[model samples]
Structures are given as C-alpha cells and as structure tokens.
Target: MNKYVLSLLCVSSMSFAATPFIYHDFDEAMQIRNYPKAFALTNRILNYDGKQFFELGRSLYNQYNPSVLPSRSEPIIPKHIHQIWIGGPLPEVFKKYIDTWKQMHPDWGYTLWTDENVRELFPLHNQSYYDESEGMGVKSDLLKWEIIYRFGGVYVDVDYECLQPLDELHHLYDFYTAYQPLDAFFVQLGAALYAAHPEHLILKHCIETIQDDWHHKGAPKKSGPCHFSKSFMAVAGENGSRDIAFPSFYFYPLGSKERVLRRSQWVREGAYAIHHWAMSWMPINTRRQEFRTFENERSSKVWND
Candidate 1:
C-alpha cells in the first residue's frame, strides 16, 4: 500500500470516530446562527486549532449584513463550462460522460484546468499554505470561485454526469445553486453545479470569504459547502423565493434512500445532472478505485433493471 493511501485511511478512521460529535455541535451552532461556535466545533472535529476558523467566522459575521436586495435584472446565458482536474486527465468513464454533455451542447465552451494552470490563474500569497490532508482539494474549491468570478459560467464537478443542456435553466436566474440538505433544519447550498453572471455579489462574497479564511483545518467546512451555504444564506436569507434553489433530486440525488431504491425511475424523472459524490478529498489512488467500483455498481443496477 502507498504511504499516501495509508495516511488517508488513518484520517478517515479519525473522521468516522468524530462524526457524531461534529454533527451534534454543528446542528446546535447553526440553530442559533452562532457561526463562531460552528467554526470551533469543526476545528475540534478535525483535530486542529488554527486561526482560520475564528477569522472566517468573524469575517462572515461582519460581511453578512445585507440590507438591500440584489438586483434582479435580465438573466444572462453563461457561455463557459468549467471543470477542474488537478492530478491529470479524468478517468475514461468520466471523460465519456463529459463528452456526451459536449455533444449535446456544441456551442458551449469547456475548459479543463490543471493544478499548475489553476495556481497561475489565482496565485496564493503563502506558497506553503496547506489545508487538511487533501490540500489540493481545498485549492480546487477555491479555484472554482476564481474561475467563475473571472468568467461568468457554470462550474460543474467532473464527476457530475450532465444529462441535458442547461440553457433553459441558465436564463431563469442571475445566480443559482441547488440544495444539499444536511438535516431537516439545515439546507447546505451546494457548489458542485452552480451558474452565475460575472461579479455576482454572492459569488464575490464566497471568493472574498475563502481568501480571508484560507488556512482552516477542514476544506469542506472552511471553503466548500459550509462556507458557500453560510455566505448564500447571509445574502439570500431563509426566504426560499429570493433565489433559484433546486431540490436535491436535481443535483445530489445519489445519496438518498428513495433514489437508491428507485434508481432508474428517479433518473428518468428529474436530475439534470447527477453528482457522483466523488469524495475527491481522499487520496487519488483510493478515490479512483472507489469511482470505478461505484460506476460499475450503478451501471449494473440501472441497466439490468
């Protein structure tokens, strides 16, 4: 076994042990809108005491006073589709899936950015900075914001299989993202498949917040879903009518029991794009093996039925 794989397994073990406590504390913090407490809980779960978590909480608290509604002008059709792969080309199965999307939308531009290219596009001040065991994954999360902010478009994770053209959905909102429900109380707005016009305030807020709080213990908590959810909620509030938020069935349908039980039926009914839950933060070798196994299982189930 590779040293990196061993390290990741150890981290995974630790995470499994800590998950219950993390969930309890996070639920409590989010209930009262105590972002500082939430951040502290995340740090404890991840077993690190860094300045990034506290700083992120403070920055968000100061930045979240949205007194005015964002301008709802005519929506612009985003032209670019951005995907990031830091290690190398995507696996053959994923590439084929992306190609199907390209064939469906020939006019749309696709850009696959690598690690060096991402760093060149968005330079970090501290070259030695690292976040979590999967540092590159954190960088990938940050890169998505910079790329989308610079050139307005949809940023999709490569693992997501695009089932149809997003042109119609693109015209519906100036900015949009789907929900990944954490529990009954918390609905985390996902970053996997989102579209926005250049310089959208919510996207701007996400980018700025990540930049200020770049060095946290956990990437997902600091700059991934948690950060995006908080920033979005701050600007959009709890009002469902304010922004275009898709139900989980549209973007993240794989994890649900209903979807797993009625896989084919669910796939045919909705789901413009399906997130594979690639678990990209794991070691590359581990994730690649898991991806292959998952794809095989899904394909067998979906096709055989």
Candidate 2:
C-alpha cells in the first residue's frame, strides 16, 4: 500500500473508534457565510449521507418539521398580516418605515431578509437545478418557498414602503406573489399575495413539479428554467381558479409597476404606495429615481430570525 493511503487508513480507523462530536461556532461562522462549516457540524451529529444530511440540515435550520411545527390550519389564524421587508443589507430608512408600518398595523409581523443569511441557509450549489432568469433562479426560489412554508404569510421588498393598512386583504388570495406579465402589460405592483388558503396544496404541487422538470432536464438538454409567472399560472390551474386575487392598488401604488412608470403618468396622479421593485433604490438617471418621500415616520425595533 502507498504510504499516503496507509496514513489515511490509520486516520479513518482512529476516527471510527472515537465518536464524532458536533460543535457549532455560530458567532464566528456568521462573520462569513460559512455554509460548509455549518454543513460539517450538522454531518457530525447525524450519520446520514450527503443526500439525507442536507435535507435534515435545511429542515432543522428553517424549523420545518411537518409533524411538530404548526400547520397552516392550526390555532394561528393570524390576527394580523405577517409581512417581510426583505433586501440586501438593511438601511436606516428601512428601520423608519418598519416602525411606521407597525404603528399603522399593530398586529403585523415584520422580518428582515438579508442576503448573507439566505446564502448560509440555502446555497446555490444545493438546489436541484438552477436557472438565472426565474426571479432569482431555482435555488433562490426553493429558499423563498422554505421561508413561506415556515412563516406562512406575505413578503414584500424593503423598497416598497407601506402607505395603508393591509388588513383589508386578509383572505383574498390562495398563493401570493408580485405578479407581472412578461410583456409588462398587466402588472401587479408591490409584493402582497395571500397564502393562508387550505387549497394552497395545488400551488405547492405545481412548484414541486416544475422543480422536478428542471432537475431531470439533464446536461445533454440544457434549457432555461421555467419562469415564475408560468409556475404561478400552473398554481392557478391546479387550484381550479381562473385568476388569483391580487391586492388592489390601495395596497400598492401605480409607480410600483416598474414598466408602467416609464410610459404612464399614474405616479404623478398621487398613487397610494410606490413599489421600487428590483431597481427600487438605484436611480436610473437624474430624471428617474426610485426613492419616494414618506409623510409619516417612526423609530425601529429588532427581531430575531
């Protein structure tokens, strides 16, 4: 046997004899997105192979166990709307808006979605199959789904500040999303969608099926992943509904639709809430800026993920 192989065998033998202990250096690990380290720590605790290991880790990390975790139909009927103001690194402006929104909707749930934390929980390499164009690619979508599954509510980009109460749209939608036609003709601005319906299994199945198709495409027949709108349509079909009810403009402003803002004058007419969308913060040119001044403002509060 080779000398290196003999050394490896000895190490393996010793490792087998001694038990593996799982230790998580969460504080240090969070400094940089230490997915590999987190994965290794998880592996030490569970004897599952690489396949089962990842699923187990994700389940634990997201606090998603079908048996233990509360179901959507359980005691929590959600007295107030659960919302998230997600973006890259949170800005000071966000804190101000969160405070104001909380005051307006006292029972609302608020969460911050940061890029660093997402990467740690769901790495791109781990997704079944990924494509770049589907909002954030398949990997990102799966992570988003995980969030919805765990939290059970609506998600809005931080760029979209609240202007009115969201209580009006308590149970109008089955699966909620920021909808826009590929042509940008009929766009639903702002990220307000309902997901508390019992029939959401239809939407869930559609998402899983598309993910399967992407996974099985194989290297020989590479293709762009399915668009999110297409998947949403699939959900609508499964739920036996012609159209998913999107919250009316009262929840969002006309400027929220990125395309409509360029060609139309809805923004000038005084819309309720503006949706910055993808380019929410970045100014296109001096003439076209994404930020809007708010009349009311307040302080901030901290919450753990």
Q: How well does each candidate superpose onto the true structure, as a TM-score? A: 0.62, 0.45
What is the alpha-carbon lDDT for the whole of candidate 2?
0.35
Which 10 successive residues of model 1 have the least lDDT summed?
17-26
lDDT of 1 by residue, 72-131 (tens): 345474767888877554566466446645654678888888855666674542223322
Scored by lDDT, model 1 comes in at 0.54
| Index of the highest-TM-score prediction | 1
Residue 301, candidate 1: alpha-carbon lDDT: 25
Best by lDDT: 1
283, model 1: CA deviation in Å? 4.4
Which lDDT values do the candidates have, in the order given? 0.54, 0.35
Worst 10 residues of 2 by lDDT: 296-305
